[model samples]
Target: MTSPEGGGPGTPAPLAPLPPSAPLPASAASDLVLPRYGAGALSDVVPSALAALGVEGEHDLLGLPPSDRYVVMLVDGLGWHLLHRHAEDAPFLTGEGRIRRSLTVGAPSTTSTSLASLGTGLPPGRHGIVGYTMAIPGTDRLLNTLRWDTTVEPLVWQPHQTAFERGVQAGVAVTTVSRKAFRGSGITVAGLRGGEFVPADSAGQATAGTVEASRRGDRSLVYLYEGDLDWTGHRAGVNSPAWRHQLSALDHFAARLRSALPADVVLLVTGDHGMLDVAPDRRVDVDSAPQLRAGVRMVGGDPRLRYLYTHEGAAGDVVATWRERLGDGALVLGRDEAIATGWFGEVEDRVRPRIGDVVIAALDETAVECRRDFPMEPLMVGWHGSLTAEEMLVPLVVAD
Candidate 1:
């Protein structure tokens, strides 16, 4: 029972706990199980954003007062904690009223699930974008949805219509402002399809596009995204100066958009997911641990959160072994237990296969790494894809 590569083996040492001001857990909020926006929990938020743009829905959460314009600035990987930590860096965003809240971005907390949830206004269960990489069920090959390197046709694989499409159908002028290169990417096809695409190569360009989109009136919904913050956070630790620099840039971007948009426009800002800093020494490469790999088939997921698809009859043993090995650093649960606990939010029949037989959720920055395969220099430092408040709970900052 020697220590693992990055951190020592057995029970992992606890890092600084999340801030006391963090949002309460979903279970604490209500006794009745709420469908995740798409699977149905507090999904009204999507309609609320739509309502602000004049999209007629029985469930509108925006509650905008006759305003004909709306802008949803989705900062990639901008978690509430990260934002709160650098409030001064994000002066424009912090100066506004704080609507601090968190939303689950599905298991694995990768870009695919979070982006799909954001675009479709549905949980991963309904939308089917489950993880960073998933073996197309019944097949041995893994599909990378973000890069769209898969056998199935992108549209056919993920057929759910995006909220953007619904908004367009409801006569709201909908536009997606993002990196010019992603104008028609597979990820966009699966989740963010239906809206007019506005190509923007820089944060300033994106901010300008959002402002212009809102100014057009006649009920407009603009989706603006920034990717550098998440990129920096992943390669560099969340606390690193690089991450802070990105936050400062985000502040400037928010301010520019805030000043440029019409006063009547309701600007809502949120993120796909948060991040955690994984210690280089604590990383445990499953590739080298024979016992850990015993019954596991394909390992899919990012570092912080993992999905272990075990051999047909070995799930129980795998779970027991992992739980015994990792202790409190990771929570090992069976597929049924995970669903019963509402981690995936009312699992639909179609989504069940997408989940792993055994789910491993890292409770802290400590991640289950595959060292033999993954390098150290560029190893993931700020990792995510877990259920912790830092990874699962994102903010919903609104400005009038």
Candidate 2:
């Protein structure tokens, strides 16, 4: 399995100039389930919730019915397909009339990107946190968005007004019920800012906090988050006994939170992304393969999705090499081709540099791991951050 280099993750190599290249054939993108940014997507959740609460300018693009209060609970890693497969473990979430539909999360289906999209009510292109980790513009260094670089201001990195902020401006009471540790984190400040933060570390606290926050005003929006399942999935495979146990606990949490909310409150449960277990044999370690490392300047994104920032004038060769080496196990595309496919939903000019010169989205159960750059990644059995149905399809369950 792949591991990180001695310099640790996000260590930069020099950037080489990349010349223009031919776009990938249309068939290259046909099989991909591209994110539906303006339609039924995670990004549309908050906007639709705000609209349901009668916020003046917010539109219910997701077609949610009218409600005075909304409790949006994001159970991290609860993919629609995963939940359906383990329905018995989560009866409350899969019960009749609970699941409205599955929503497509943003490309590079990681928590940072999806949350930014969900909070800002905009695509990754607009929000600018394009991946879990991405190159900091004009520098060889990569920014691990979750850990975040202190020098880069969160507010400046993501300048758009969040849905929570917009809801507050429109006279709606908006609150966020999440772990106390996340109250002032970079991800929260950058994407989910501008709401009353109520810290809740346990299921009981989450239930009580969500109920109380939803009653803040006649028009209220409350967002609750639980990351236990995601943490379990990463530590253990998605279908492993541990993951299933976590699913059961999550179902109980949801049931408790739902039962405690006032009758008028609408409960919407969703997830950031899904996960699939990758066998050690299925992983191709770039650190062990010189050809795979050739022309590469730095690595970003996660194992399932790789952002290969190549050296000057090396993108074409790097893309060709990766396509040839990975063969049918991955879809390798140039940056321009990737953008044209609308995976990121109309990327901004400033955001373009954050994307790699060559992007590789894993196909099937394959993973491209760089042991040296990402030491801990290869050890994790379950992974996401690609466009597969398993990684992109999150449920939007409505319980009233």
Candidate 3:
């Protein structure tokens, strides 16, 4: 190895140190278990806290010590790996809540799926809100589960009782403080229905309202959400100036919450997924790529992970074409393979059909995109919805 330029794959190449924005090399990296839903995951946070507060439920594998009150704050797209990369930007995070460990978000690592997991204390397989967009079975059209069509009832589609409902049933005071518009959204009705709805338009208001809610009862739970950080990342990539500015804003918000919350009240800050900035050239346009569309009936999920429903008897060709075309930068799998891999974490019988016959998951900076059908998505730079550590591993940064 020394004779060959004195270097090998294990040797550190002498070059300018790569910045956080630099894309990582493609190679099979170390592996981690599927998001441990019942053990350590976004899904476990509330239940763990509930167990800490003496609620009746599955024992907490996380062992949170103990706390009387909790304010669960979820910042959209705040992946654990992303936080470490830009830790300097968030002083409060790097200072008080900073730690080496992280918790996994549910599969696809998208908002709706993970939120359902968090709220219901179950994985995607059991709760059944599996992706950002899932096909309404027996229909050609894919239902944007977030926006959601009016015909479907949220409670009926996802019939599992949420943790909030359980908390309320146990006579625990539960309040949900979120965007004014989110009170009755499909996401709200399905997973976050039992808690008292408190609308807050600004971070200041949300934090302040949660503080008040904490003081109201001996046994209380308050859930808070911040979307601006995720919004900025989606619009201008996680590496963009806009996203950094938003990170600073999040730091200030975290500081405010830290200063205001009662000592007994613990704040658990987490995110649904992390994001990656996909270069324009790296984006594979399925609409324009004929091979990608050869046997595909429709496409769903998003840029990082694609759900390719196929025509009758075309799953084999489609999978081969996608893999051959996309090459090393992607993980192309059939329905059975995706489920068996536990990427979706125990796919349910009813929800199984919603998954694409062929799934294309970008392994590195590669993204599968569409310009013809979804015009806005193509323009966005930051993307998520995959199993990569950058997207699945999120912080459970705790503030006592």
Candidate 4:
């Protein structure tokens, strides 16, 4: 694969540690980096764009400079740490002034939760799409937010109006460019609705659609979604050559979009979350571990982050057992403690039960999988959705 203006793809770059930021909360666990909500976060992106577009009542929390036309591209699974690690493969993106700063993805660091935060300009607590798969209150089954169980109404599950809708109401031309298959998907209705949907099957189409939408009304906000990189990471671990090649392709796509847009248009690139390769020995299968099975009723969330719904009054035992068995490989906390740490950011009473009775966040490269519950999860090479820096820190590149 041909790389952009950066160093040759053959040149390997040293993985850089996360840039220093504000001090962590004293209450936070040693292994966790709490999501920075209401400040620099995925939720702040759209509101910041709206503010830059001169939309009234919207706050530019990210401090985005003024711009008449804005095109915000979300590159799924493009994390800040990952970008620096493979900077040679994506020269155009890592160029000086191209990256504004890093933003903390919402808790769990999963696509569904982060996307909801990005679209609604609200934390997971308010948006209600807390995880990839969460318990549907009053039901025994899990609602897969990505695949989206149609039986559940999207609007009702997440009642808040999206930032895109708010932009339209303010007379700003808002358009979303993504795969045609996602035109009216459940997640779209719940998080990204209230804007005109433009289908773009390829990178060229995405560039065309974005350029056209950016040229609309005096003030325009266009959102473009790219998921191929994330898909590649899930199938072939981020450390694989395939992922590096895909990164190069995505870099070219961004370069095309930036060059096509007018000078005055501000092009911002960001991502939902990051990923890390999980080894087979590093995984703990709950299906085979009798201690992990005791008292747990249903499993939600993903391998990296687990939500274990416990039977009545079994939450304490389940938490204790998980902490003991997993010992240092994960941080096991009850729902109240997880909320108290502000990982979910103000959990609403209505959205509380959807969280697990016992929450487990895999530390480092460890994963707690239940192959019996989610058969396909263990088969994946890459995993995310924990609070580690590798998964939680995503870039906010200002490719103007």
Say which prediction, candidate 3 or candidate 4, comes out ahead on TM-score: 4
lDDT string, candidate 3, 1-59, tens digits = 43222335555322221123334455432322368766678888888878877887646
Evaluate model 1: give its lDDT.
Answer: 0.72
Which is the winner by TM-score between candidate 1 and candidate 2? 2
Q: How far is 125's C-alpha from truth in model 1 (Å)? A: 0.6
- Model 2 lDDT per residue over 1-400, tens place: 2322223245533222122222334565554678998889999999999998888888898788899899998988999999999999999999998899999999889999998888999999889998989999989998898889988889988998999999999988999999999888899999999879999998888888888898997689998889999999998999799999999999998998888899999999999999999887678777654566889999998888899999999999999888876666679999998888888998888899999899999866778888888899888999999898899999999998
User: What does candidate 4's lDDT look like per residue over 1-400, in tens digits?
Assistant: 3222123455422222222333444443776778999889999999999999899999998879899889999999999999999999999899888889999998878998988899999999988988999999898999999889989999998999999999999999999999999988999999998879999999889999999999999889999999999999999999999999999999988988888998999999999999999887777777654556789999998888899998999999999877876666778999998889888898888899999999999776778888987888878999999999899999999976
Off by over 4 Å in 2: 1-28
RMSD list, candidates in order: 5.4, 5.9, 8.2, 9.9
TM-score of each: 0.86, 0.93, 0.91, 0.92
Q: Worst lDDT window (10 residues) for model 4?
A: 12-21
lDDT values, one for every candidate: 0.72, 0.88, 0.80, 0.88
Candidate 1 TM-score over all chains jointly: 0.86
Cα deviation at 183, candidate 4, in Å, is 1.3
Candidate 1 C-alpha lDDT tens digits along 107-221:
5566788788778877777777878876678876667777777466768767877788898898888888989888878888888898688899976688777877776547788
Model 4 / residue 161 / CA error / Å: 1.5
